[model samples]
Target chain A: MVDREKLYQAILTGDAKSARALTEEALKESVDPKELLDKTLIPAMDEVGRLFETNEYFVPELLISARAMKSALELIKPLLAEKGAEPAGRVAIGTVKGDLHDIGKNLVAAMLEGGGFEVVDLGVDVSPEAFVTAAKDKGASIIALSALLTTTMPAMKKVVAALEEAGIRERVKVMIGGAPITQRYADEIGADGYSDNASGAVALARSLAAKVPAAA
Target chain B: MPVSQPTIPRLEEFLFGHARCPVTCGNHLEIGAGTVIPEVNFTLQAIEICPENWADIREQYSLMIEDLCRRAVELEVPGILFEFETLPPMTVNPAWGLEITEILSETIDRFHQSHGLRAALRLTPNDTRDHRRPPRMRSGPFWEGMVEFLHKAPHAGADLLAIESTGGKEVSDEGLMNADLKKVVFALGVLAPRDMEYLWGEILSACEGTDTVPSGDTACGFANTAMVLADRNMLPKVFAAVIRVASVPRDLVAYRVGARGPSKDCAYEGPYLKALAGVPISMEGRTAACAHLSHVGNIAQAVCDCWSNESVQKVRLLSADAPTVSLEQLAYDCRLMNVAGQSREDARKLRDWLVESDSALDPQAYVLRPDVVLRIASEIAREPTPYLQTRRAARAALREINRAFEEGRLRIPDRERRWLERLAKEAEELPDREEDLIAECLPETSRETFLPEEYGLS
Candidate 1:
């Protein structure tokens, strides 16, 4: 039997070496890879994310744990894929046109991936047209728009309008997030949802994904 | 689903220019702490100083109007649009009002004389203000002042006048909507149908509420909000509105990237850098501008500290003292570092060469050399306390060297480990003076005052 508790501890402590070794050992012992991921890795990462959101852990700690989780996932990704695994949902994300800030978008992308979503990142200063194109091309169910400037907030509306113009407004749910974006703004823009933080974004994406016909 | 064609070409054109020449493109400006005033002759003076190389100039309304007038008189440059950011009252000391008007008038006078520049001013207001200060006043007084100043400019003056809406601290949708943007436009006294047409829509759109509010502190947040509101046509009247507020330009409007008030803790960097690099400014000026921001300076120093070569170290040391150091010594030091070979023998040869060629090897260089400087300072210093202080200073010096190394800004041998060992030894001895140093170096902020109970160091 594998010491799943120890594995969990390793993940929380960001002990990549120990976590990797223990996870591999568990696999060798006939432990299901999915069980190790679901019961041990994911839960540990979730706690890390919570600690991060609560300010109990700073960037350095979060980065280390994220790195550890990434390494561990690399080893498990193959097995998961071999079993015909799919992400929770597909998301197309970007900072709106004219605004070039990316940290918030990047954090949300990380969290979305962590939450089992395939994220197609359209880098900063992305236009409304780019967002629509990326969503349609990637077959994404959710479009996450981020803006950190009051000046660029209008670009978000333009992007929403572009989506409507492209006839994909109904096909994809639009979720907005950023330092300047708010629930009120989301409502004003007629966006599907708005979240203030990465954790909330993931949860929101997951909830919205469930409502999508294709995702469902 | 049909994929929409990207608007990248428009963005690139707006950003880079039709020719796509980086040097020919307009760049953003960092408006240092200054005042904008509306005056005629002053406006002409401003146009004379306007950097001809720049295409887009972001400034406050007062400055933008002045720049426009100046461009008109001096360069004959037409259609020179200026984005003016409106700031909250709290951010501006009322005492600086006159100064602001002075700067603005001078900028406009120059534009009027040149007949070369057309002008558009975007207003960005600061989102933070102390309620205790005074009741909120919209653009009325400012427009009146601007109109009085523009009346003095020559007829058929600079082309455009556009008002930009900005986010302010503690400003709510209701507060903005209640503020009379129309009255402000009336004060501008630019009753020409074209001017009125431009101003009314912007002001009204700015007055409309948006789902998103200002991020409370970041300039980018206010700028973003303004953009969103403008797009929704919720922004108050445009007869006074200068431009369609957008997040890209707003992120670039700041004295420094992360400075207090009117800057979002997030955003600004990516867009600003992209816009700046796309401009035609000289590399030296660009480097200086980049270093002017604390964040950029810190990153540069961090990179320098990580890797440094002897040549790099020499350049840094020389540059640090260039204002005070002799030119002959600077040249000699440069030559010494440029020489090949690294060993005790090489060091000795360099020392001999220095003695033979120059009166004395620059003491500062020797004082900064990882092995030699520490060894000498340690010998002269009486106790570990001074030694630690000296070590800290040396670390600061070496930090520059390290950055030069990593940036390939200079060429030097990799000696980070040896330097780290020295730093660690110095850190070990730091306990004796740690409290004193912290007291001297760490300034108190509102959040942490270094209370005795917090550190128990008392």
Candidate 2:
């Protein structure tokens, strides 16, 4: 059996090689990949995320741990696929039109992915029509819109309207975020949710995904 | 043993007194705000130095000035041209003009002594015409105060004093008609031939008088009246006043002209560029100028603007590349370009091409910072998939390491601690890559190239 303690240590220390080696060794010993993933990798990452959110860990540490988790995941993915393990959910995201800033959107996207969501990121200056099209095409359960400029805030409302007009507004929850965007503005625009930062976005996405019907 | 002061190399030679163009048109002088110092953004560069914020100013001002002087010297640019202004302290009333002048005189002397740099001081008297809460410049009192201030300027170590014709309800036409340009010029001409000459002669009896540029208004817009003087062979006096203060080499006094607006203004655009081209002077415009010409977006426009200008042979382009470019590469290229000026054109072209080609890989193209990977991971954590599954797994590992460090499970060394300190300082202002920080912490010889996988970015 793989040493779960050592695997956890490797994850915590951001040791990619050790994590991969231990994960592969466990797989060879016929240990369930999902069990190792859920117990060791997920828990390890959850701790990392908590630390990051608390300001205890910074970008470098976060990046290193992410790299280690990636290597370990590569070793276990085929086995998980064979076992028919499902992902958390699907999401569509972009920066609103006329706004070229994307750091906030990118951070949310990274955090969402770290939370185990499949994100279709339509890059900056994406029109409302483009957001709706991407949502429909990807069958995304959530649509996250971002705008950094006060000038570009109107673009977010236009995008939400476009989604409503497409008759897919009810199908996907729209979440708006950015530096200048506030919860009051989000409510005023009739958005399903609003998050201030990347970590909050992940938590919001998880809650939104839980509300979605399994059949849909 | 006394600590030795660092020697500042005279990168650019001052020609003392020479005339490149005997007859020159009026040029636009940006005053009120400071000169756009080298390296920093235009807005920050032009901010007024406030004594109230002196602590912050003291932290960066010396370094900023040193950098600016070094760049000017290295680029072999002519002497610095600056518009000097003093705001009455919040605690003091407007009647303390003498005190304000004394404070300003002390500050200017200290600035010059510390940097071994002198500046042309254009003194604008307070406008008190409006009966508002704070009285502005009253035309008569203003000129009288300036003349008094000029009498004491030489003793305070000021090189030259020019009258600023900026204020009043009449100065709104964007032309010299409303401004006090003619009055200031006449005053200089009248006094310069008599009392001013005696005062200046006494002030600089040890040095040559040929280096001075005669006093004139800090012209707003393309001063059409000043152009008329240039046509009449009277520009030599004004140029002499400038030379007295700055001692600029004749070949290096680049006359820059541009429209005054926060953004692009069509009405001013045509006239401004036309005036610049007519004056046989260099033109300085923002990103809009290049964006309009190149029809490109973002940094590409800025790069093209600075590079396309034949006059900007010694250009310093800011934020030219996305943060995704390796820090090591960026720093290396910056130093390399400074050493060898020939690579500017090629570097700009390469940068433009890189932006175009890397548009797709830009996962968070909406944001300019390079921390998009973090966002992607967070999203994937909540909604998993085959495509994002790998990314989520990678982010998890990164988070784990972060957690360990936070919990004090991992101990960082002293050398690495210093590196982290520097990184923390830099990151407070700007977001940067962790791998880059790690590399920076390492010894110069031991520093390794950052791999995307090493930081879970891949």
Candidate 3:
């Protein structure tokens, strides 16, 4: 029997070494990889997110803890794949065309990954066409766009319009955020959703993923 | 976002152009101070050099710095500021960065010893423009490097350590890229405790941070804030706020915003209008106008202008010399004084004198000093303020009753001194005038919104 509480503690405190050792030991004892993720990693990240909202934990803590969780997840990823474990959702994320701001985008990407989403980060200054192609190819449930500048906001609108021209508007949920983006602006640009912060972005991604029709 | 030279204000905004200068760019050498009149000009910006050229660039940078220092002294201006930031490929390597810092520190000591220039050097933890940093500074390695740089640089000879983040700027229209210490850096909840030769300045250009992207205190992220908070706990405080964003974090060592700035109009105009009824009454902190390419002498003139002003000088003196009043309370008092028909200059002097008088005399008795009487008398007689009608009444009431008293022209009986005190109280306690004027100037009706209710109590 695995000390599940100890595993949870290791993940919560961001103890990557203990987490890795525990996971390897748990695997030898035939513990379920999906169970570890669902019951341990996801729940720990949920607490990290909650702490962040309450101001008890900040970005540095989040980054370090997420890294710790990743250390353990790397060991479990193969087993989960062998067992055909489904990710919570697939998210294709990028900073829109002509906007190179990525701190916010990267934070959301990491948080989404911690939230059990398979993220395909398109990096900075990604074109509208690349986003549409990646969304279809990756079967991403949510297409997350980030822009830090007001000048690049029109690019976010263009990405959404590009998806529509490609005939995939109905299937994909386009979520946009950045310094200049507001929910009203999101609606104006036809994006499915907009989040102000990374934690909120995670919550929005999970909600959107649940609403995404199950893969055919 | 890119910090492009704005569309407005052609570089030829100056009264006279230097035809023989090597550079052709229109220049306004703006510093962190202001220009009082049309004759005042801007200062040269702190220059930087790429890391690969550290060895080679030293001669060029040194000669420019030496010339600038010599000229600054001749102009009687305060020392200049320059920085050595981590550039990609050459300076990012920790050992290399530390070596450059060591060399720079030695050079700084030599300059001070030789030229008596009070030039300050800033150590940036991470350059948001450094593209070569590991993607997202992966696994907080970026922060680790910064921490190492900070620990070693001060020992090497830095005058200041600005926990700077450029956020992101465009090199050209070619691409939009943002890099930050936030990517792979952790704001250590704990700062390295050290000797206090240097001060910390925050340059977090985060006026536009959204909910997801919190630029902890305007442009400064968590690392800078955490360090500031830590310094607050340490003895002989070690931080100053140098913000470049829309908002200013409330701190005692603050260089606050320009009330009207960055508009496409003038090269860079600050809050105080020189023609505000011919009385310069702004309590706004020193600010430089924008002239993207200014000469060294121009910035020195602006600094000189700001330092020459009594209001600016008084604020600097109050912050540095006196410990009785917090700067926030002083600013609050200035707002009240400005409303009460006092020019910003008199207000600062009064506040400084009040604190001095408060500390010197018996706590119970308020004795009128020569400094206090003369200041009040001069302010009452100075001008007819157009801001409010009650301002007129407030000035008139004090002027009528205190005219003889201030100049030592009145002979007061011992018993009648109480009556003179009563009239003085009346001048201060006049109805509806003060509350209305202060409320009008405030951003919010409840002062608690702009600052904490118990702001200076601590």
lDDT of each: 0.40, 0.41, 0.43
Question: Quality of candidate 3's docking, in CAPRI categories?
Answer: incorrect
lDDT of 2 at B320: 24
**TM accuracy, model 3:** 0.43
Off by over 4 Å in 1: B1-458
A41-127 in candidate 2: lDDT tens per residue? 878877777776765554435556766877888777777778888656788899887564454576577667656677898877788
Interface RMSD of 3: 15.2
lDDT of 1 by residue, B285-318 (tens): 0112211221121111110101001010011233
Off by over 4 Å in 2: B1-418, B421-458
> How many collisions between residues are there in candidate 1?
121
Question: Tens digit of lDDT per residue, candidate 1, span A67-176?
Answer: 67776777787888899886678899998765545556766787777666778988677878888888788788899999865546777788889989998888889999
lDDT of 3 by residue, A31-86 (tens): 88898888888898889888766556546456667777888888998998899887
Which predicted model would earn the best lDDT?
3
Candidate 2 lDDT over residue span B183-228, tens digit each: 2222222111222223333223322233222232222212222222
- Indicate whether candidate 1 or candidate 3 has the larger TM-score: 3
Better candidate number, 1 or 3, judged by lDDT: 3
Docking class of 2: incorrect
